[model samples]
Target: MSKLSISQAAKLKGVSTQTLRRWEAEGKLIPERTAGGHRRYDLAQLMGTKSELSFTVGYARVSSHDQKEDLLRQVEVIELFCASNGWQVEIIQDIGSGLNYSKKGLKRLINLITDHRVERLVLTHKDRLLRFGSELIFSLCEIFGTEVVIINRTEDSFFEEDLAEDVLEIITVFSARLYGSRSHKNKQLLQELKNVARQL
Candidate 1:
């Protein structure tokens, strides 16, 4: 069996290396690895499938200044999931709030999608890629005629699961820290936010 390196496979398919990595993480596609712990793609994996286009690409992201914190752990989880499932991925690291559309890594991902001329996407979760409401982002994906698969979505309730309540609690803690260190109305807002968060 002829094995192709990740880069060679990407170059052959004319997609970005990053996109392949994300697909791998989303449990959409997997690549065989070389003896040196390097990733290799099978040419047949990119062609001759029923879809007549066996090529696949993946994209992953996390938004936090402390990327090495929980974000890094999340990446590791996604990676293991992809590796076990025989998928390829593209990893993008950004150190900013997800609310920022102009994030450097995100922009690169967008460009790679357009530049590569593919129509498939993979994400860990909808919330990971989008923290805020993203009507515009959805529209862009539609315009690109892309089919996206969220490998690990919080809303996949049919799977008998949901975002861990602890995750939301951590978010509440961050919000509290941001506003609690204040006076007057700030304290009131903190209390209100806490109440709302508790309700969540």
Candidate 2:
């Protein structure tokens, strides 16, 4: 019959305060409101059966096929982190430009989020999710009551290289659109861009 504050409840449940908030939004575990409108949870109720918990998702990505080794490393890190937290996680991996939204793995991840099948989404780094517009996905997670866990929030060393590749992808797409995909001009423009990127 003990009532616990949000933080206390989160600690007792081995999850984050944000995850508890998300659960509240999903109507999975609505808490009582204090006189100050703060959330309070029943200790026994907070420790729900494992069957009621949703699974966690670990997402790992690298910018190109050549970085397959790095992708595996990312997966390993995510797995170890989840294991340390005693979280049951499914790892989704992608080997493509971070700017590409149509990656099969990414699509699957988004579908899982929209379906509310994921309790949490873990990532090695923010940019691994996307080079740009990652906030949009994070917002979707918020709406779907999915908590996002970034293992390393600090800037990564290969960020510049990945960014350069993403930039090249953008230029390639635009150039193709402007002068047909098979056009000589498009090919020449892309080559020049690639050469410039190489110099930097």
lDDT of 2: 0.83
Report the lDDT tens digits of candidate 2 across residue range 1-200.
Answer: 59999988876665667778777776889899999999989877877724254678999988888788888999999999998987878999988888899999999999998987787899989989888889999999988878899999999767978877787777876775756657787678778888887565
Candidate 2: stretches off by over 4 Å: 1-5, 17-48, 51-53, 171-189
Model 1 agreement with the true structure over 78-127: per-residue lDDT tens digits:
66765655555456666555555777877876775565344456566675
Error of 1 at 6 (Å): 24
* Candidate 1 clash figure, as a count: 18
Worst 10 residues of 2 by lDDT: 46-55
- Candidate models: Cα lDDT each: 0.57, 0.83
Question: For every candidate structure, what is the RMSD over all alpha carbons to the true structure, in angstroms?
Answer: 12.1, 3.7
lDDT comparing candidate 1 with the true structure = 0.57
